[model samples]
Target: MHTAPQKFSRALTALAALTLAAGSAHAAAPSYVGTWASDLAQCKVPQERPEAPLVLQEKRFDQYETHCTFSSAEGAGDEWKVKANCQVEGDAQAYDFTLTVSGDTLTLTDDAGSQDLLRCR
Candidate 1:
């Protein structure tokens, strides 16, 4: 009832499925999704800090009293451009920020200026 060719094809299909599953199992989160701070000491501060740690999610970020929800983020592994509506000191504002990451350092650039941060462990 079973032909050699059919068995070979089935085996190949199973192998392909196994390979895909293995690859996906080892997939990692994007490099930009993490907590970053000015230094390790800053990581011990509150959830996020104005001049220290910055907590980032896929579509939002928080630093001290500043909370931002971004509409879109465009970029690759270690760099991204984000457009967000944020509340800073109780005032609403629109902001566009550029984030670049290298090793443990994260550099964020905005209308005001650029600041470098370290990844929190």
Candidate 2:
């Protein structure tokens, strides 16, 4: 019972809705999901070494002698704060840190200081 133009209009509306859904889904993903190192050259180091890239997943981050597991990341825009339970040098620790992303670099600021990491391509 639909006219040709009417059907086309419905299709366009559906397409726009679908496009918006896709964009929102992509936006919901955290931008900092990747393996990162202090520099690109550091990516070549073995995981056992201090110079190894840090591997960050949705719920965890791992480096040479440090690992942290957290429930979630919370923030808007380019910065997110994470409260993580961590293990450093075999000692359990709690850490509150902020992760900021700029292009292919991630800067993590903790109580110690800020460390800049380059995304491993």
Candidate 3:
């Protein structure tokens, strides 16, 4: 007992809902979900000695060797933010960092400065 216009409207509404669900399902994974090595040159780290590589393992997202333990992480598109407790020198510090990734390159920004890293193969 539906008019042509009513049927069309219902179909349009169903299509819209399906589109929204598909969009959510297609959300991209966080780009920082892998191991990265400091690009000493781009990061401007002193050439005296190379910096230790960083590893962001799955699930827990614990960055090995960097002394960073992320408690919460959120990602939207290519951007990610994490709240972490990290050991700097010998002191434990709370750090929040924003990261952006493009291709094999990732840039991490924090209170100090931004550093560029390359994905580890």
Candidate 4:
């Protein structure tokens, strides 16, 4: 009960549907292009200086702009900014770091030095 013309038409229709679905799926994905900021306590610090919290803000991926406000428990605070490159690890959406990630820590480097940003969930 199947004709060659009908088979060809059905195949074309299926192909068209597949193409449309693929295009829509690609378009619906969110591009990581915004400024993300988090509280100072969210970032992990070195064990020697564990009493201080660091505020971190990242703007633009290509031009990694970070603002940090680190304050010691005793009411001392220091702020700094560093420009570098950044990228996301694997295909994760919530876990992005600067281009200087090493081992399990995300690193930020500039004319000053490098700092590691441990991922905190």
* Candidate No. with top lDDT: 2
Task: Score each candidate by Cα lDDT.
Answer: 0.88, 0.89, 0.71, 0.39
Model 4 lDDT per residue over 37-89, tens place: 23345344432343333323333332122222222111111222333333322
- The superposed Cα distance between candidate 1 and the true structure at residue 28, in angstroms, equals 3.7
C-alpha lDDT of residue 11 in model 3: 100
Whichever of 1 and 2 has more lDDT, that candidate is 2
lDDT of 3 by residue, 25-46 (tens): 9876577777677663433332
**Against the true structure, candidate 4 has what lDDT?**
0.39
Q: Please tell me which model should have the higher TM-score, number 3 or number 4.
A: 3
Model 1 TM-score is 0.76
Question: Residue 109 lDDT in model 1?
Answer: 97
Relative to the true structure, candidate 3 reaches a TM of 0.57
Which stretch of 10 consecutive residues in model 3 shows the poorest summed lDDT? 40-49
What TM-score would each prediction reach against the true structure?
A: 0.76, 0.73, 0.57, 0.30
Q: Highest TM-score, which number?
A: 1
Off by over 4 Å in 3: 1-29, 40-50, 58-65
lDDT score, residue 2, model 1?
82
User: On residues 5-87, what C-alpha lDDT tens digit does candidate 2 reach at each position?
Assistant: 99999999999999999998876557888899887898888889877899988789999999999866898678999999999
Q: Which residue pairs collide in model 4, if any?
A: 40-54
lDDT of 1 by residue, 10-102 (tens): 999999999999999987766777899877998888854456588888889888888899899999899999999999989999999999999
- Candidate 1 weakest lDDT stretch, 10 residues: 44-53
